[model samples]
Target: MGFADYPFTSRYQTIDGHRLHYIDEGQGPTLLFLHGNPTSSYLWRNVIKPLRDRYRCVAPDLIGFGRSDKPELDYRFLTHYHYIREFVAALDLKDVTLVLHDWGGPIGFRLAQQEPRRVARLCFMETFPFTFDWEEFPLAARPLFFAFRRQRLSYWLLQRHNLFVDLVLRLSTFRPLPRSVMAAYRAPFPDARSRYPIRVFPGELPINDRDTEAHRAIEEIERGLAGMPQPMLLLHFHPGAVLGRSRVAWLAQRLPDLEVVDGGRGLHYVPEDRPERIAEALEDWLRRRLPEPVRGALPAARVAAEDDRFGGALTWTFADTEHGGMVAAWSSHGLVMLSFAEDVDDGRAQLARRFPKASLEAADQGAIANLLAAPAATPLHLVGTPFQRAVWRALLEIPPGQTRHYGELAHALRSQARAVGSAVGSNRIALLVPCHRVVPRAGGLGGYHWGVARKKALLAAEGVKEP
Candidate 1:
């Protein structure tokens, strides 16, 4: 039900006698992310992580998808739409900005058309607003999808073998996905019955009026789009499956306040290939086009309360160290914060900066000493973006007395050196996270939070020779 990369609180709502799972994080204007078939809320994990800091990001595992309950109902287009509408109603989510992908495009657009005022904006990718003709579809993908339309064949491929989770997803992305990520996508559909929803989804594709109900639904959504006045963002990419260049142009002509951005190199699964790019584009759009909603949606007091929900009561103390005085803070969860400082007062001040929302209390001096003595063994209550957490996890893998350059760490994470360096800079638990082990690839020690001298000293103590 959970993955390390998707480190968010799981929330559920009872909708039509079924339990629908979702991840609701941060506060302010709502960003309701709707996923498509063969994927779930897990698809938006990386995309949601950074945006959650500024926006109320809510992504639900649609009924029969991800961790949601799989009722034996007809998993049809209207069925999904009905459940999503009810789910939104249960949460009383108003002034929502829809983030749509794949089948989510049609479902979300229908919601906006039906309840235009409730939805403030729309952002979508790899999703189409209308049904497609056979000729319009990607040539290479047509045969596979055509076969999926056959009930018996689709059952065997999608249900028994799990084709989408196993093969299609890997092919749809520009780069190969990590094994852990693929595992998360496969976790929900472990058996034939569990994958029924996935099998039904392909059949629901409204191609050339084949699926009358879905076709009509999509046409209705399309016809009403030009009249809808919400601001929209279209993240288009090359070699698209559902939404190609022509579709982007079609959307631009319809959406009055549309802002289109090239979401970099990606295929059907844009989120997997370029989550950072997608997040940056969406964030920029929000900041520039809808600053009022982004900043002024929630009351200041309410915002503070929601943000401080974690690390409720942090106990902190100063631990004397050879290099300098060290500050340490811990919550019931684990060690929350640790840093190098000048003195006891300086240590306390540093802890205040780290855990501003936390109600600070004096911890046992002995416990703080024990933590300093063996920090690697202490469990860390690390707070960071998924990318930052990934980098920190890799950092922990580096043995003591060893060092890795920024490029090497970046290569391991399948990220750029600059991005990895940014994550390294944001490390909270200093010595334990081992950011000091990361040096400049060219030669010498790079920048450190405490000081270069302190970094060199820490590295030397770990038996790492200065380059």
Candidate 2:
């Protein structure tokens, strides 16, 4: 369908002297959509229309695309990010649920990271942060990106010819893009000069440290992901050009609260191919998180064969401790995380990062509170690999008063000591998982995920004091 076929209100704001266009429809909590290369707010035509009645849905054309003013400036990844940050600020958006694809992922991620309070929920479709060694690229596509370094030839394909609209987009999308939609996509870049942003995008694919800004942002995004408590939803498609099966799984594994829904027979342009499924995926997740009562107009339709509607919910309680306070969290499976620190926020942040989609709340005033008040023995649901799980079980085997060095557990598991140390570092259940019991063989405590002083206190409480 053409942009006109799916109608909505079009709005613009002068962000940094340049007018940026966006689709702003519906009302109530804001749901912001960010587009990538060769596409603009038009990409979200199908997604925004369906949920406009109950929610204020927005799809913005990045500076160079759609009706936005295409300024003649060096368009780097950071440049796009600054514009997006300014767009959100200019509108003074609050409690935003971000729907991001392609370049939008990194741009939106950095914005959310810097201002966590403004953003509440996120939906990632056919996207990955720019990090990792060049060798880590998916085997099928490595050659394509590797060859993109030949800037002269790549620039010809991007600027001289309408390769993205005429060839790449058509190839990437599953559904046929009729003449009208093609005309809409081609409408922006009437000539080579306006397509400079597209020219820079391909070569700017952050491989290794080559794209320094992207590389640093990737590292920070990956690192910050482990701390960001926002609930995330991922739409995993069959064949994205770069984001393949392995990349999707790796991302899902890291975010404790990420729910993955299958986008059938779709590629990198999954948004174009499967907009109905995409809308449903966001709608289903928002139903659970939306504070207001679910309205009738926003009907919940189940999307795809693989339903990822459930996850990232945690039942937690806080109790006063001698050192400070402890937060105990439990999943439906069992007691999953136990943590002691100065306040409950540390544990909450950890659980939020680990189970990004899980609901976290205070335990009722009863036995649950008693459990949080003290380290009540409960069956643990460990979060890790087989080796990590085995290492944690080994730690649990240690008598409360006794301690084991990293080497001792490694030898017992018949694995490398570093592997044991890594697992110890990742332990979620803390005292119950008993990772604090594992220490350095040399002398002083090796490390603790919580704190060295807390580790010492736990050890001292059990009879073995920290060196």
Candidate 3:
């Protein structure tokens, strides 16, 4: 869907009682676009319209920017993190492909680490997750910060008395933004009152040692980014404030797998200046990195458990007295069988007989097992083909906290919507694998091998909006 064609939506959520504004468009592999300081989802306007044909694009204004409510909230790292977590939870997006820039680096990186298996890949530009190690600020950046600190001075200096947006557009691009495009960027904050976020953003930068709290979060994000094995593609602009050969080299040394794109002589806003190149890079990376399709049967001993956390205790018992806690058995290679038993120990013994070499571990901090013991959620193992496995891996990329529909999944898989449904039904490690988050094309709860009621409960508990 085109930018204009997609309507903006708002929802009143309990988190801070803020009305979060977001745009959800198209169908396919989810592309979560996150904006940084002084800008909103509108920064993605030029890029999203082109990529939406092949991917679902969901972009939201950070709590204090764009059409979202700007309350007297603490504008700290943790606060932004909470909003982002709630935003995705409310929508129930999964298997997410994150597109980050500037401040988005830390925000999106934290979310990825929170649920590593849920993120498929990452694409970021002009961003840094490091702290204390940042290169010296550029001379041009100095003026910007100067303007930022002298809020009163900047207010009168800029003819319109709103230099934040003007500076963003001017310094953001190597080439001047088109007149119309520049106008659109400034449209969100028409007056000084609406520009509080912009005025306060620079002061939020953790530039020195005294800014401990924000710097600590930055350090945490840097450590997480360093350890992430997920494919990361960095699109960097040359000769920009945040981009340079030395910084690029540093990142390369840190994230050896990271791919860096040097937009020769381009400005910080690489997405706007080189949209097609960015799109091509993303498409190529996805094709090369996505795992090859493999057909297989669900292992019999592997049970599907659902809960808020994966490492929790079992909440229900599928085994009887004879086979305690053992719900299914599977061949080492593929096929598995499901059995209901009265005895938990007998179930374990039965599963051991089926696959002596298979290991058992609680999923997601014992959350799944806890849910299984209480029967508070659905538990089922899915069996399917190699094509289905590829489909399942794609499903895992949805960020821990987001959801998508069957049609969107199909588009991401480059298959028919019906085929996507069939594959989704075959998922075996539900909750841990997160197939429960995928819904129907009409935005309703879809089928679940365990039961539809369980699916609804899980989605509702996760804060997903249901039709």
Shift in Å, residue 223, candidate 3: 2.6
For 43-85, candidate 1 gives per-residue lDDT tens digits of 9988998899899999999899999999998999989999999
Better of 1 and 2 by lDDT: 1
Model 3: number of backbone collisions: 67
Provide the lowest-lDDT 10-residue window in model 3: 301-310
For candidate 2, the per-residue lDDT at 93 reads 86
TM-score of each model, in listed order: 0.62, 0.63, 0.63
lDDT of 3 by residue, 1-467 (tens): 43223234443444557787788877777889888877778777767767778778899888878778878876676778789888888777766789998788778888877865455568888776776432466666676666665647655633246766676656677656766666666777777667766666565565663466777777777776656645577876677667577878888777624667655566677666666667777777666544442233233312221111123223222433221223543233322334333355665664455334455532333432444454323323333333355567677677755788887866665445665677677665555456888877675677887677767766777777665
What's the candidate order when arranged by decreasing lDDT? Answer: 1, 2, 3
**Residue 6 CA displacement from its true place in model 1, Å:** 0.9
lDDT per residue as tens, model 2, 306-405: 0122264568876665556667776555676666646667767766676666677777635345554554445455544334555666877888889888
For residue 64, give model 2's deviation from the true position in Å: 0.9
Candidate 1 yields a Cα-based lDDT of 0.80
Angstrom error at residue 407, model 2: 31
